[model samples]
Target: MNWCTRCVLPDTRPGIVLDAAGVCSACRAHGTRDEAVDWAARAAAFGELVERTRALDRRWDCVIPVSGGKDSTWQVVTCLEHGLHPLAVTWRTPGRTPLGQQNLDNLISLGVDHVDFTCSPLVERRFLLASLDRFGTTAIPMHLALFNVPLTVAARYDVPLVVWGENSAAEYVGDTAATHRLDAEWVRRYGAVHGTTAADWVSDELTERDLAPYFGPTDAELEAKGIEAVFLGEYLRWDPEMTARVAAEHGFRARDEGPRTGVYAHADIDDDFISIHHHLKWPKFGFTRSFDNLSLEIRNGRLTRDEAIARLRELGDETPYDDIAKFSAYVGIGTDDFFARAERWRNPDVWTRRDDGVWTIEGFLVDDWPWS
Candidate 1:
């Protein structure tokens, strides 16, 4: 697999492009921002958006999709600081941890009306198992609900704006097509829902009514209502550490146990099952959440590529064994069967079985990778 010379990311990752200089597209995109982002101008633009939305004289100025994570807290704080009344909305994950609930309550205490939108547990279970069985991901249902519910709320309430934390396409994949505005096309291409909508999942087991929450107002409907969805990261510089610090100042707590999915002690802590989604990237893409986190650190000058690679080596075989067990029980599937399903989706191009009956990635970035 070809690797980025500048960072640790591989071209094997979807939407990652390695240019002739051996720099990945994400690095190239970040470089442009480092050189060209005029924070003053961006902030002015955001201020204008706030003023324009406020002129509408709506009950709520915006809808902020939140998970009580650091980024969510940061978004809430930023929006409130701008004098925008935001209604924080959460697509309540079935696997939400106790810490998640506490953090969420803390977010609400920061002074914003909140909605904890929960899909029927039965529907979530069926959809999660279906996604795992078919697409090798347990996150499609989560993404669908997370992306949709906020838009639905915006439409229902006639809120003129939806404030999302980051433009993930620009931040992670470096898609040139990424923009500050989010529309239906962008969600289908970059939302990580496999380009399928809630309608695509209809079956004898799940009816149209069962998946109602997953269907947001259509783009045409939203357009007719003059609602706009935008990324807050576009206006302000986004740094995980910075956001974590901001969140901590506002009572957002990190996992006391330590980092769950990646190197961040503050991230992915709200949902227990989210780690399973990140861990699955190992067999399928020959990388883990550490790769993504470390790559970002490399971009931010926090770690050299060599140092990040060493850290990845030290983080060896980051299989979320406990998360897998938790997800298996939640979905009412045996652990053995769950792993069998995961292993079936392992990318053959990135992995090969060794003579000792262990799988290994040939020419892995780390010379002494622990395949066992």
Candidate 2:
């Protein structure tokens, strides 16, 4: 709720720190760019990685599972530029937003042969509803869609190396442990909890069991096959600004025309679900979806914490109409249940209860709800 005096980040951001002068570390780092980043060296290392990794057997030098976001585009282009025969994989999740589908289509048009993995919509819907009801969220398959599906495909097809768009800790947040450099542990403990983020708000339908499908090789499996999922950001210094500029030359657009931080910069792509969730988290955790991005913006002095928070507050809960209707129908519940759960998780102060014993928005439930 409170903006940091020195940086463009608000106190709502988790694990934020302020110096005596009220400045943030991102601001401090800005002063040391010459020492912090060596773009030439980074680019060279990236080239080296492509040359070296591609020299490996060529069964599939590497695979980049892409959603065709700015970052993914960069990753794919870089893989080719580096001389790697990279196979692209895309998962056709049920009810993919139009913008998301467009992004995917654009990615495929780049002449990269891609394999789309789409599962049973009924099964996906059942799990999506279960997770949404239990966790007050509909974006439950995020973990599986992002990590598991591509990984499973890689494993089954004998692809040894899988490349990800970016690494969170080094690019976005400060996880100053020595492991910040690309290494084995980066893959092992990539997350804080079981995976993804916290358990506070997830879809209930997607159980831990659902994740078992994507867990990439047992130690035995990885060892026997030498399977490695690498974060391209590591080893190569990640320059989001440069990545965006180049991606634009190759035709990248922001999904929402909003500020594309982190992996986005091209001014058009899908911003509703990811953007809305980040905006919602503002009042609760005080950070947007892309924390490192906010930090980067702060370091560069493009944004102020007050401005970020205010902008975040201005965002609305914009769910696509078809997605809302289909998800509601799939859950076998009306849209009321979906809205009620979402309102409860987002801003508890807005859920209104019926004075006449019906659930309505007559009043926000913050003061009335037991959870508050």
Candidate 3:
């Protein structure tokens, strides 16, 4: 439960490495970018990639997977700015917020051809519930669809390139080697699926046919089609605040209230279940969306350790009771059952219950903040 000395990230976060100097690997990785990256050369390489892909005989030059979030809007706009014809693809979440729908419509108004893919909600709900019961997350199916559907469309449409956003390994967890590219192996290992394939989820109630949409292209299939995927962040400096501001100028709307767990005013608004999914992580890992956002701000030089810790204390725990009722019903569970499952997943090693029935974690750097 130890925390990074330089940022708000906790050591409990999986795959995180803290150096002898006490800076988290993510911070160390950002330092490398500041000191060593050549943005101009990366941008040139991106331009060349676009040119090469556009030269292919397909009607669309590339596929851009989108969720109408700020990052996705930025991706679509970036492709358009580079004179590349990108077909925007969205795998519709179970609960689409009005604001999310509005922003998506606005993105479509930007003149890019868009496709919204939706699987059978009945099957999706079953998978969602199964994931929740087994992994304490309702996002597994969504993650699988997000990663697979775009590739499915690209293959069907004969597009040879798919442009993705930042490499999570490089930007979030500090695997610099993966910063330059994203492949199927990387997607399964680090992306939403996290090595759990759709086939692994098949059961008596859920058949292989019902899970077909979650199956991404095989490596051989991708190679046969000459398809490639690259991260846009590698070509440009990735600043979330800057991207959100730019997206706002193009009609992207921020949430009226900030998200249930994160400081960002305009992220993960497409689904109500997102907050619940993130909240579920707290019991297992002893951190939440607030920690994630604050760590990013610290790395980007927007907040000091004290400031970030103070803000986290003010925000408090981000349990999404507000949306729990609706979300539980959506997944065919009762609110009591939802709470029971959430409590069941709380790792005893990371949490302790007080006499008053309040739960807390120790070893968080925030507890040792100088001002606190």
Point out where model 2 deviates above 4 Å.
11-34, 37-39, 133-140, 178-213, 236-241, 255-268, 279-283, 286-295, 304-332, 343-372
Any idea how many clashes model 1 has? 0
Leading candidate by lDDT: 1
How many pairs of residues collide in each model? 0, 15, 0
Quote the positional error of residue 55 for candidate 3 in Å: 1.3
lDDT of 3 by residue, 1-372 (tens): 778898888887766889898889998989788678889998999999988887885899889999898999999999999888889999998788888899999988987999999999899989988888888777789888998999999888888999998788888888887636666678776875657988899999899999999988876888799988788998888888988988998989998877645888888787877888788878888888888888899988999988998998787657788778879888788999999988888889888777777776766555742221
Global lDDT scores for all candidate models: 0.92, 0.56, 0.84
**Span of ten consecutive residues with least summed lDDT in model 3:** 363-372
Give the C-alpha miss distance for residue 341 in model 3, angstroms.
Answer: 0.9
lDDT for each residue of candidate 1 in 232-315, tens digit (9 for 90 to 100): 998888989999999999999999988988998899999989999998888889888889999999999999999998999888
Clashing pairs in 3: none
Task: Give the residue spans of candidate 3 off by over 4 A.
Answer: 368-372
Off by over 4 Å in 1: none
Root-mean-square deviation of every model: 1.0, 6.5, 2.3
lDDT of 2 at 169: 52
TM-score of 3: 0.96
Q: Give the Å error, residue 223, model 2.
A: 4.1
